[model samples]
Target: MARRSYKTELGCIACEDLSLLGAGKEGWLVDNPNILCAIDTHSVALANRSTILVLGWSDSDGSRLKIRPELSPIEAEYVSAIEWLVFDEIRVIVAGTSCGYMLIYSLRGDLIHKQMVYPGRVIKLRIHGTKKDLIQDTLSGELCVVTPGAIARFDGSDIQNMLLKWFEETHAHFWGLKPKRQGSEDFGNSHEKLPYQLWNVSKYGNCADAAITGIMPPPLIEVQSSQRYYCAVAIGDDAVISAFRLSEDKSRSLVGTILSKVVPATFSTISSLSKMIWRSEQTSPKKPDQKPQSFARAAPLTCLKDHPRKGEKLTLSPSGTLAAITDSLGRILLLDTKALVVVRLWKGYRDASCLFMEMLVNKDIASSSSKYYEPSKSDYCLCLAIHAPRKGIIEIWQMRTGPRLRTIPCAKGSKMLQPSHPFGASMSSSPYVPLEVFLLNGDSGQISVLNRTLDT
Candidate 1:
């Protein structure tokens, strides 16, 4: 029989060697440093076990920041996850530790903030943001911190607010422009502890990976207008897929209860002069301290149990409506989050890594448009790039309903990488930048971009 052949339509170009600038000068990264994880965007951040090197792509010879996550002398923890966080104009690097702490570092390598999110080890940090229209006020974003047994969410606006306050206070102190007031020593530390929602997703099994799919709008008949609801999805053993509906706790806090009783007692005392018996009870000077609580409840929505087939990874769509999950049985399942149903499935892709990407399908119309004409969001079509190591090929499949577009030969031990969303970038303010994926060859120590598309 003749040997089968593959096409070269999906090709990649060589990327710059990451060990060329300051990192190379300091002899920190070897010729082929065993990169455990990395994120490529405006800058490239490569992490090994303990160190992370970040540098910009615009200037090859520019300075690079080498960061080592600070750990206590008694604690032994290493970096588990890393992501670039954008707060409006300010950008920072956030790294998760094995001991369940989130460390935020400035671009200059200073530790900006650190907090213990969970008792269990942090599995991953996922950030999802969307802009429905061009005239939206700000991007609706949420940061999901995943652990073995739970997941936590930090609203984008809350983070931005906290960071802004911390920076302003630090600037004032640095310039000696602000007077030292009571509790000034704890000013910066207290500001970093932003309120977050946590949920226990361990009901099915330990979560290997999870994502906050989307935040649902409140119902018309809802009583609490301020409470926000969310939908979360997780994957692990015993249960291949599990989803939960997360909402804030409805119970009143100690402070709320105390204030409520005080208001009624004060009004009664004013009306009835004989109500002096309750005066001593309400005259206490000390207030009850609020302890750390989950402040949220997770109700099981659905559970898909598939024994002997554990889920390894989860990739969410730009809109978070769909999820692509890979299982141990060498299959990929496309799941709809809102409906909680598997819409598509592909088998025979063992050890396959997948990422969601976009391709410009209507090139003819794009070319025919005027030079200044901006292409709308509809010009591009969503696609999935599956890098199958066993077959040494990278296949592009149109998301849910389309056929496989093209298959490109790839080397073994190669992995596909996509830059995280353009954090803090407004759809109306900045020009549209289509999402793209890059190829990283572990054997060759070479990086390449997925620049070509079949268009059809």
Candidate 2:
């Protein structure tokens, strides 16, 4: 690896950590103008001009970002949380807010649609890639799906619905358990009742803790046309990365299985010294119970990028890799499907303030550096963007080598120091060729585009 350096400049006033980043034929949009609010991204068609949907609260007016020249004037509000789903060249912006409502927006940033999605906040939103094109929306209190023709709502809450569906589909029936037991007759014609149990026999025993003791249904899966799909799951304290394939009939199936479970180490000790005490009534000395202590481990799944080619999916280095997950701790693990291990771990800090990775121009490296680097193998290394809070700086790591590549100091009193919360810091690449990097300034609500500046 060779060292590289670049310049930094200020761009737009995002005034908040961007919640969503996406680009299309129309343009790009950064939604939710405040710190850590759920933002949405979508392309919109406007007369002869193409426009990108930028959803955010106005800094001046303190109003949610909605289409100008309002038609229905339905102020979209998300009581709990919000998530965006894009499919069939259309953007489905769903917000789960108070009073069990969901606001829907098209790619054009128009409120042409609305639904009483849920009585609570929406936690997750997903869209299936099958030809049927089903939109799965999970709210804090319910799970429902909206299709081109009809919308199906499930009773209970989203979590419960997920648990039931998981047990029914994966043959892991134990997840849908409530306390109930059977009785058998004893020798004296008396009935002996067994302990009440929930969950099916196969999976109930494997559950690690009470957190997972409750049902966790599988996420609404997608089957892309590439015959492969990426699955990123945030599991208890840890994150999991897996790739799946779809049958010719479009049934989603597991592909090259990959498990990135974080295993933590444990230590124990016992006091060697004896204690002395005076008491009127002497009691027998009791032995202290000896048990080893264990530490719970967890990691965040930040980003995932699939290889552009096709072949053995499991062979991560060979076939297209499925996903890349980054944690707040700043550990970047690249999964190699074939080896079934993290092929590369890009370490920036024991923990990261914010990190982003994207595939950029391969030729830019040639003219920019004389290190005699090929655009293929090394070019595949997506550009690394990092926000180091300790230094109050945002640095771009172009190459994998020494020295600060490009550093931009954020304005003093910015909120980057806050723990990893939604919208603390986010980055996105423009969909156009010769990729453009956009950094969201959560504190100032400014969006800055990173471009090469020539010395005057």
Evaluated with lDDT, which candidate comes out highest? Answer: 1
Candidate 2 C-alpha error for residue 318, in Å: 17
Writing each residue's lDDT as its tens digit, candidate 1 over 1-456 gives 664343222322223544432232322332333354555554667776577777554444345677876665556687778887775678777788888888777777766677778766778888777774565566757788899888888777777777787678767877889875344334534544767777778889898899988877654565866777888899998789999887776454343344446655676677467446455444447543233344356778899987899999999988899899999999999999988999999999997888998876777754564777665677779998888878978898887889987787887656677766655677765456777887655444455667534532
Residues 10-115, candidate 2: write the lDDT tens digits: 4333423232332221213212222123332211111101112343333442323433322222544323434444322233444433333344443334343233
Candidate with best TM-score: 1
TM-score for candidate 1, residues paired by index: 0.77
Ten-residue region with minimum lDDT total, candidate 1: 6-15
lDDT of each: 0.72, 0.31
